[model samples]
Target: MRLLGIVGWTFCAALLAACGGNGDKVNTPGPVTPGQSSASISSNTAVSSLSRSSNNSSLSSGAMVMTCASVEGAVFIDETCPNWQEPSVFEQQKVNSNIYYEVPFGSDGALVSQKIIDSGDALYKKVWDIQYNNNNDFNGLPHFRAAAAFPAGVDMSAYATGKLIFDIKVLASPEANPDFTVHIECGWPCYSTDVRIPIDELNTWKTYELSVADLIRDGLKITNVAMGFQIIPRWGQQTNTHFQIDNIRWVKGSAPVTTKKCFAQHFDRTDWSYTTKVETVDQMPLDSSKWLAGVGPLVTLIPQWNSVGAAWGFSVRDTETLSSCAAKGTLSVSVLLPSAYVDDGQMQLGFYFISRSGLYYILDGIPASRLKADEWNTISTTIPAGKISNAEYMGVYFDSKGSNVANGYILLDNFVITHSLVQ
Candidate 1:
């Protein structure tokens, strides 16, 4: 049987709700404290001990905040996806310093139009254009207004070692035609764009941590750093579509990650599904072989899984087909998990992958410090070939944990596995 109804919705909705705010209160369904496991690594380590302190800080809500931005005029919603059917439009209330942009649509796929918050509004929304049918399935190109510059100049060079903190609400478009990366123009006006990071899913609001140093190494400059959206078309065609947007911010002087491209990948366009029971596990194998959990639970057929109180993911297991010590196979997956449930003892979420190298581990555990209780978060990791084993098959996993009874939930999508240089 499927885990259905309002309880399931409350769980998932509460989780997504936890991703924003002024970094004040913890918003999940539980108290503020650490949860289940402690041990963690960068996918470069083994499952040695489960007791060691993992970098739970990565899950906490600290420096991330969305102060209220002024807005004026009519913010309307329209039909921009494949079918020009109008989806439900809800309230655009500015809550707790963060703008909550809500759209009510059924499981059936429908593109929610862009809400225009006047140019003179604190954000000057016009700088960020919501273009349709540009070149991809449900495409949107957000151009920053010259006025939207950093109080401190945007240095593409500094991003290599600075911090990238911003929140985005997106719905998975399709598998092979997934939402593209968040590009920034680094030079003057910072107009030269590159996909430094992609918004791997649909139907959820995800807050991302972008490493400034890593951005520079990836060919982005530090001057005039600007963020925008770009989506590709699917079904062997291109079309313009509308997606939602709200609470976008960038914190200055943030930390950066190491610069290195370590994975080869393939294109995907599958949507997301939702669930709240053991049977939900049956839906997310990489492939039909069952050896690999393709994508399930919270993944919609048309790929929209952004409903409230729901969590989704993908997984894969490996066989003895790779070298045991090669140190560099290919691991390419992009994931976004809303941090809304980090403080909810009733909620636990994570991703797991087993390699053919006879090695296996998980990317999740109980909540810790890095992830806050009610905010959206973006996480990316690579699975090296040799990191597992020379086994023939490998498996991948994505799970959002909670009390069997349920309280809070998660929204997730965009399962990608690519080749990278790892050891």
Candidate 2:
């Protein structure tokens, strides 16, 4: 599938220049559109275009600014930049072999394999040149590469949440490979898996988008994602095909609010741990005077959590037990946690609080799974005002229990305190 394409519109220069309102200096990309050519296309194509649009007179307050940075070779890092040792000595040697690192792309001269050299004559170089111009698969052989270790540390057991986004296009030429392939692989010292994508085909440019959410849904993690591409076969395993690639961008993507927020930042997991770290939560004492819910234990705090149908509810019985319900409320509390807990793939933890309700609801469900075991995870809860009318304390509980006893304990450290008025 052509993963991502223009949502509905293009950032034409005239349109962009018209976006600026009241002289808010906006930035834009250069004059070249998808298929257009530039005078100094080699050394300054991307940079020059970005520079020209730096002072875009037309910018809208509501429109998001899509900035372009050099998309060369690079890897994602975390907020807590921990000391990282390369996962393998081979990684060091392989990287050293490349003339230049091209990121989602690949090392320089990566396209030059023995086959191209063997062809030697002009016909061979023509084929090689055509492969680079028309092929979608660039940087196929020396696939995905990463820093020695994750930004925080190397805990292959822990899940890492990451994201990537970039624009891709096809170059015009007589000699070009219409069909191309790019595959992302998790490499060395870690389990291997690949997601291959066909980028350029028959003269077209498009954007490719992928997220950690996909991994969570598939029970995977960000750390397992690596960059690489597949060379389309010319004939029966010949293994000598080529492609061109540019504008590759990869980064950690945040979860969207459209879905149930299930298994996202709170309890998203990879491996056995519930991983999507809640790096931040809004928590504080609730205005116990009032609480409301759609029905049953699913309570809400009136106008406080005004975004009806937007927030989640969890009834806490005690530290390790919970009653879960989907609720809408007015006054409520949210707690932001550190990234460690969100992306770590934790499976269990406990919250402590007292409630006024006779049956203090212990409402808890992972953001993704019904109840996953061993994997790292995260969870969030909203206590309506009236729900805690009589009780004084309460907490969200975490645990890892299943067919196996080895994954029975959970750990938690970051805490947040904040609340909203009973809406």
Candidate 3:
């Protein structure tokens, strides 16, 4: 299993007999994306669409091409700058072949596989074209792999601000083989980061953006990167499959992510953790605080929290430990106020989760000045889940909206959520 502190190894193809006939050496490749970093790493990450031969080789043989200096978040790096090259020899070699060189991919070109004639063909300028079948699976590995290791000194801190990018499109469908899966793997400190996304979007030049923060949350570190960058395929058993991959980069933008909804929390003394914040002792007139349950006789006062004054903000306890309730959901509460309370003050509520670690509450409604007065109003609004993929919890802020109050209080009870996926 891929977990913290565990690692995996992949070797280079050893014998020429393992290769599918040597196609003629091809052309140079270009790169892409953008980001921000503290280290001296290049911030220009942009991909220029270069014209290519049918196989993806550059139209002009031996002519230099332009690519992203880096995709951590920056726009574009100047490839024309002679000083721009792989930082060390470690980043310039094949995994098993210690040739101390960048393996040329595509028809013959790009990245750690700069220009050495290796396994795949260059479909176009700065892109690697791999046409693989089960017979060509190197050393009987699970799938088709195109990988290049970056030397030890390369810092991936910039990824925190952006995403990992893969510019690719499939030329064949699962009809080539039913169980097709594309695995993007990176070796980070303490563990290997592998994301398995199903090969579903077929035969289109689609750009996939993966969040860098999400990887770190899964136990990857930005400090130590000891693995080669690779995109491999698995379970493509037959029916020749063709694909063009280029602009493998760390970028500033993010690809759209899918969401699964089903979570909720009810604010009850038995279900909540903030029991100490409220009290059971009533300060009102004798029997005034008694509950009048519709179907029951009468009930005494119970532990509860009451908010007094303006700008009162309270959240569920330990939401930090739960999955982010980010983008969408609902927050509802039973609210009661003074008889003279007006509808001038507004209420705000929402969800927020950043980097899969911190929990933040967004502004659901501040200009919302429609809270009913005196009687208990079940106030609720939709939660934005897109703001946080894994939403942890939610909160509501009762703002006076600049209206001065005279010893007023907002009584809240039975706060809860609906369709919340978090436990």
Highest lDDT model number: 3
Compared with the true structure, what per-residue lDDT tens digits does model 2 show for residues 1-423? 010111121112211111000101111112211111111001111100000111111121112222223222222111101222211111112234454333232223333331112223221121112132222323324332343443222222121233333333334423244333332333322221122233335334344443333322222233344322222322122124443322233443232212221111111112211111111011222332333222111112221322212221232221111222122221111222233333434322323333323223333223212222222222333433333333222334332221111211222211212222222
Candidate 1 residues 1-423, lDDT tens each? 122111110111111111111101111111112112222223432211011001112222222332333211101211112111222332222223243332423321122233343334343232122323333323223333222433332333422343444434443343433434444443332222222334455544444554443333222334544332222222232234334444333434433332233211111112211111111222331222222233332222111223333333233222222224224432322233334334334433343433333233334232322343322233333343343333222222323333232223333322223232223
lDDT of each: 0.29, 0.25, 0.32
- The alpha-carbon deviation from the true structure for residue 9 of candidate 1, after best TM-score superposition, in angstroms, is 30
Sort the candidates on lDDT, descending order. Answer: 3, 1, 2
Candidate 3 stretches greater than 4 Å from native: 1-66, 70-125, 134-153, 173-193, 235-239, 253-423
- Over all chains combined, what TM-score does candidate 3 have? 0.31
Error of 2 at 420 (Å): 24
Per-residue lDDT of candidate 3, residues 269-332 (tens digit): 2223331121111112222132221110101122122332224333333233234433445444
**Measured by TM-score, how close is model 1 to the native structure?**
0.32
Error (Å) of candidate 3 at residue 414 is 36
**Model 3 Cα shift for residue 328 (angstroms):** 24
Q: Each model's number of backbone clashes?
A: 117, 98, 52
When 2 and 3 are scored with TM-score, the better candidate is 3
TM-score ranking from best to worst? 1, 3, 2
